[model samples]
Target chain A: MHETALTQNLINIACRALEGKGVTKVNSVTLCVGALSGVLYDAMEFAFDAMKQGTVLETADLDFEELPVTARCRDCAYEYNPVGFPYICPVCGGRYFEIIGGEEVYIKNIDCIGDDDVVTD
Target chain B: MSQIKVNTDLKALNNEIAAQNKEKLHSCGILTVDVLGSPGSGKTTLLENILPELAAKCRVAVIEGDLATENDARRIEKTGVKAVQINTNGGCHLDAKMIERQFEKIDLENTDVLVIENVGNLVCPVSFALGEDLRIVVLSTAEGEDKPLKYPTAMLKTDAVVVSKTDIAEYVCVSTDKLIGNIGTVNPDVKIFTAGKTDGEYRAEGLVEYILEARKNLK
Candidate 1:
C-alpha cells in the first residue's frame, strides 16, 4: 500500500530530475531497498509496474539493490547483523541497537535514453 | 540517451514532511507521541484510562486514526478532551500528512501534549513517522507473547511498550514475564509498563507518568 506512494514519489523524482537534461525516455530506474525498512520488494515492484503506466516511468525498468539489515549496539557500540530471531547484538547480547543500515530506501540512479546518450538494445 | 545520475530516498519526501511536522509541533511546544498496536490490542483502552490523568497535569489532545470510523475519537472525547479522528479510508497506516492536516483542528496552541493514536495494526505504522517525539506500542496479554518476535519492528521502533489488559492475564495462557522478556529481546531500552486491570483496579500509572515525563522533557 505504502509502496504505491513510494513508487509515485519515484516517478515524480525521475520526471523532475529529467528536466533540463533533454532526456526523451527513462530506460530504467534503480532503487536501494533496505531490509529493515519493512518494504516488500515484490510488492513495491508490483506497485511500480501498475502505477507507472501513462507516467514518465511507463517504460522504465524498476530495479532494486536489496541491502542487508545492520545494527549498531548502543550499549557496547557493537555492530553486527542479527543471525538469529531475537535481533540481539551478538557481541554484547544487547537487543537495543541503533539501526545504522538496512533501513534505507533510495534511488541509486536513473538510466535515461535521451537523443544523445548511449542507446540500449 | 544520457545517464542522468539521480539519487533520491523514497522516504525523503515523507521524512521531509514529517520533519516539517515535527518543527511545527515543536514550535507550538506540543509534545506529540504516536501510540500504536494491533486491532484488538487494547490501545484505545489504555488511552481511555490515561487521558484523564494526563489532562489533570497538562492540556492533552488526541489525534485518533482509524480505517473509516470516528469511534475511537468519540470514545476519547467522552473523557472531555479534544480528539480529532483521521479516517485513512483503507490505508494501513497514518502518515505525516494526516497528522499535519489536524494541526489546525487540534487546538495546537493550548495543547501541551498531543497523543496520536495510530491506525490499529502491528506492521505498517512502524514504518511511518508521524512527527511524534516518542513512539509507544501497546500490546495486550490476549495478543500472545510472540508479538515482539513476529512483528519486531513495532517493538524495536517504540520508545515505550505498554502491556495492556493485565487483569485478564489469568484468562489468557500467555505469561506476563514471557511477554516482557520477549519485548526485552527485541529492544532492551524500551520502557515497559503494565496497564489495565492491575490488582482489581484499572490503572496505567506508569504509562501515564511516562507520557507526562516525555511531555515535560520534550525536545
Candidate 2:
C-alpha cells in the first residue's frame, strides 16, 4: 500500500517532466530502489501497472535497479556490504557500523515516445 | 529520440515541504517528535502514561496517524491536550503532505511540543520525513529482540529507541542486554532506554524523562 503511494510520486514525476515535450506515451521509467529504502520492487511495479492511465505514463514500464546495503564499521572504519544474518565487518569482524548507502529511492531517467513516432531514451 | 536525465530524488518535493514545516513549527517555538513502532507495540500506551508529565512542563499536542479510526486521537485528547487524527485510510505511513494539512488543525501558538504518532509499521515510515525535530521508535519486548536487526533503518534513522513493556521481559525469550547489543549493531549513537514497566503509579517515567531530555535538542 505504501508502494502505491510512492509509485504515484514516480508517475507524477514522469508526467511533470514530459508535460511539454510533445510526448505521446512513456516507454519506461528507471528507478533506483535501495535495500534500506523499504520499497518492494514487485509491489511498486504492480502499483504503476494499475495506476498509470490517462496520463503521459499510461503505457510506462518501470525498470528497477536493486541497491545492496552498504555500510562502514565504526570500530575499524571498514566498509563492507552485509548480506545476511550475523552482520559483521569482513575486515575487522566488528559488529557495529552505520549504513552509508542503499537508502536512496529516486528516478534516474525517463524513456518516452514523441508525437512524431520517435522513441526517446 | 532524446534522453532526459530526470535524476531527481523522489522525496525531493516532499522534503522541501517538510523543511518548510519544520521551520514553521520551530518559529512557533514548537518542538516536534515522531513516535514510531510496530502494531500493538505499546506506542499509545506509552504516550498515555507520559502525557501528563510532558504536559506539566509544556503544552503538548498530538497528531495521530493511523490507517483508520480516531481511536488514538481520542485517547490522546483524554489527557486534556489538543489532538488531531489523520486516517491514512489504507496508507501505511504518514508523509509530509498529510502532516502539512492536518497540522493546521492544531493551534501552534500554545503548542510547545508536537508529537506525531506515525502509523504502525516498522518498514514504510522510515522513508517518509514528517518535519520532526526527533524520531523515537518504541520496541516492545514482546516484539522480539531481532527487530532492530531486521528493521535497521527504523533504528538507525531514529534518535532514540525505547524498549517498552520490560515488565513482561521475563515472559519473552529476548534478553534486554541482547536487545541493546542488536541496537548497537545498526546505530551505536542512538540512545537506548527501557521503559513502560512499573509497580506503583509511575509507569513510563523513564520514557517520559528520556523524551523530556530530548527537548534540549529542539530549537
Candidate 3:
C-alpha cells in the first residue's frame, strides 16, 4: 500500500547519493529486501516503473536480493531460521527468541553512466 | 556503466529523525507511547478510558493522527487533556518528521507523558519508528484471532499488545485466549493486556497500570 511512497524515497535517496558525482544516467537500482520487511516485490516494481518516469532512474531496472528471517533463541543461545507460527527453537524448544535479521529494506547499489560517457548530441 | 555501492537503509532518514525525537523527549523527561491498530479497533476508546487516570498523576498530552478529520482530536479534547491533530491527508502512516513538527505546538516541558495515536493501520505503521519509548498495538476481538499471525510485522515490532473489545467476544465468537496465544507465538517477549466490559463496568485496569508502571520505571 505504501510502495509508491517507498519508491519515491528510493528515488530521492539514489539521486541524493549521485549529487555532484557527474552521473549521466541511472542504469539500475539494486535493493536488499528482507522476508520480514513486509514489502511486496510486485507492488514495488509497479510503483518504480510508474514513478521513475522523467527522473534520473527513468531507464533503471529494479533488482532485489531477498534475505531470510533469522532469530536467536535467548534461552539456549541457538540461532536458526524460524519456520512457522509459534516459533519454537528446534534445538532447545525454547519459544523466547529475538529476531536478528530480515526486517529491513536497503538500497544496495546503483549502476549509472558517468558524464564522461555521454555522447555529444 | 559503474555500480556505486550506496548500501543504505531505505528508512535511514526516518530512523535518524526518530532518534533525534527520542533524544529530545528523553531530555525533557517525557515518556512517549505510540498506539497503532486498524480502524475501528477501539484505539481511541482505550485512550479515552485510560487518559483520565493517567492525567490525574501527571501532565498528559496526545498527538492524534488520521487520514482525515479532527474527530479523534476532538474526542481526546473532551477528556480535558490537550490534543494535537495531524491529518496525514491520505498518507498511510505517521512518520518521524510529522512528529517533530508537533513539538513546536506542544509544551514538552509541561507534559510528563506524550501519547501518540498513530493513523489507524496494521501494516504501514509497523515499519515507521515514531521515537516512542513504548509501542502498543491494539486488536479488537471482532477482528478475530489470526491477526497476529497474519500481521507478524506489526506484532513483532510492538512492545505490547492490547486485546480490546473483549466485551463482545462471545457474540463475535472470538476467543481472546487464542488471540493472545497467537500474539505470543510471534512475539514471546511482548507484554499483553485486555480491555472491555466485565460485570457491567468498562475496564482497562491492566493497561492503565502498565502505562503508569512503565512511566515510573522510566525514571
Model 3: what TM-score?
Answer: 0.95
DockQ of each: 0.54, 0.49, 0.51
- The TM-score each candidate achieves on chain A is 0.81, 0.84, 0.87
List the candidate 1 regions with Cα displacement exceeding 4 Å: A75-78, A88-96, A118-121
For model 3, the stretches where C-alpha displacement exceeds 4 angstroms are: A115-121
Model 1, span B80-172: residue lDDT tens: 888998998889899998888888897788989999999988888888888999999999989998878888778878899998887787789
lDDT pick, better of 1 and 2: 1
Residue B10 of model 2 has an lDDT of: 77
The count of backbone overlaps in candidate 2 is 0
B31-103, model 2: which lDDT tens digit per residue?
8999999999888888887898899988899999999999999998898877899998888999999999976
Docking class of 2: acceptable
Ranking by DockQ: 1, 3, 2
Candidate 3 lDDT over residue span B1-219, tens digit each: 677878788888889999999999989989999999999999999999889888998889999999999999999999999999999999999999999999999999998899999999999988888899999999999999999999999999889999999999989999999999999988989999899988997788677778778888888
Say which candidate scores most in DockQ. 1
Model 1: DockQ vs. true structure? 0.54
Return the TM-score for candidate 1, rounded to 2 decimals: 0.93
lDDT of 3 by residue, A1-121 (tens): 7777788889898888777778877889999998888899999999999988988789899999998888889999899998787788899999888899888898988888886653221
